[model samples]
Target: MSLIGKEIGEFKVQSFVNNEFKEVTKEGVLGKWAVFFFYPADFTFVCPTELEDLADKYEDFKKIGCEIYSVSCDTHFVHKAWHDVSKTIKKIQYPMLADPTGTLARDFDVMIEENGLAERGSFIINPEGKIVAYEVIAGNVGRNADELFRRVQASQFVAEHGDEVCPAKWKPGAETLKPSLNLVGLL
Candidate 1:
């Protein structure tokens, strides 16, 4: 079953952040937007670039009351080591969650059992812990943080303004369409 619209905030997850272990559950995400990004592992190509990109845009996400969490199958110690050694990873202020047991990855349905790693998956969960948007990409392709920011903006916009919906390639301040039977043939 697709996890779309499913509430996943109840699941308690143990992850490492800033050299300390912590549990992240519904309470952690309460009253704020959460972005959970699952990647393969640490000390690999593509993942660092993607993470660095997100780090570069961290302020933008923070401004919107969103917290970013990057997850992988590696242990939290590994995450911290990578953060210490890799120049790119050092800039990431967001939490790097360790899913060594693959529980969180499996819950997100992005675990690759054969390799015991996570696939490229991104989930945007609202304050209520309901998943609002999700993206799963092939292992070879890295994601764009700018696009993710735009999606967050659009999602927030629609949440505040119930009558409008973002259209394809929607950007902030762009016109959104109001779904209606009368507009069925208009497109």
Candidate 2:
């Protein structure tokens, strides 16, 4: 089943941030927007690039009241090790979540049971803790933070203006379509 519009469940896990281990929890994120970014594992190919890309745009997300969380089955130690070794990862200011037991992977339905790894998944959760949007991609393909940022803006716009719908390639200032009987057969 699709996770869109579904409320997030309670969870707490260790995370690496600012050269220290911290605990991140669903409860703590309540009333705040969050981006849960799930990847296969740490110290692997492609993951760092994706993370660094997100890191570069993290301030934009933060400006929009969204906290980015990069999750993997790797432990907090592994996350720290990767951050220490990878110059790209070292630039990250977001939390590096550790999902060693695959609880998060299972919850997000991104677990690769056979390999004990997770597929690439990205979820945008609103302030109410409900998932507003999500995307799951193949392991080989990476995601774009700019696109995701735009999606977050769209979601927020729609939430504030329930009568309007964002059109293709919608940006913050773009015009929105209002559903009406008069427009039924127009577009």
Candidate 3:
């Protein structure tokens, strides 16, 4: 049941970005690197901090040709209101996707049926719209964008060099292991 290598399904939602509202679809995520961050609610305690951290690293993500999308069950109007009132969230230039109907959460399989909210989910997708990495955690736990950036780099390295695989704690310009029978049981 792993979502790895699974293409994003059809789903469209309202997104608030750059003081405007727009519709985002599964097709919209194609042809570019993207991150889908799912959180419980907008005005909660930990969400803003995590979002601000991502915002701080937004430019670095962009440098790697990645786009960030923050999703919640809240409506787009709520996203706008939070964007207006919260200075930390206001720093986010990425789109805030509104999933009031829980469709996106369900599509990502992070929805809590009883709570009508989503868990802390982080998904890294490649240019072809396939999910490359994903993590879902409890609502209280936050995520690190720097780690996500590293994962993205590692994914890109692996994609471009299919013969090579990134080792633990791999960074760009670092050494990658070539998978071959001769190297088996040597490490």
Candidate 2 lDDT, 1-86, residue by residue in tens: 88988887889999999999999998888888888999999988989889999999999999988899999999999999988998
Stretches of candidate 3 exceeding 4 Å from the true structure: 182-187
Clash pairs, model 1 backbone:
none
lDDT of 3 by residue, 53-108 (tens): 99999999999899999999999999999999999989999999999999989988
* lDDT accuracy of residue 55 in candidate 2: 96
TM-scores of all predicted structures: 0.91, 0.95, 0.95
lDDT tens digits, residue span 1-187, model 1: 7787888735566666665778777687778898999999999999999999999999999999999999999988888789879899989888888789888888888999999999999999888888889999999999999999988888889899987889989998788998797875664
Collision count for each candidate, in order: 0, 0, 0
Cα lDDT of model 1 overall? 0.88
Off by over 4 Å in 2: 181-187
Pairs clashing in candidate 2?
A: none
Candidate 2's displacement at residue 94, Å, is 0.4
| Model 3 worst lDDT window (10 residues) | 178-187
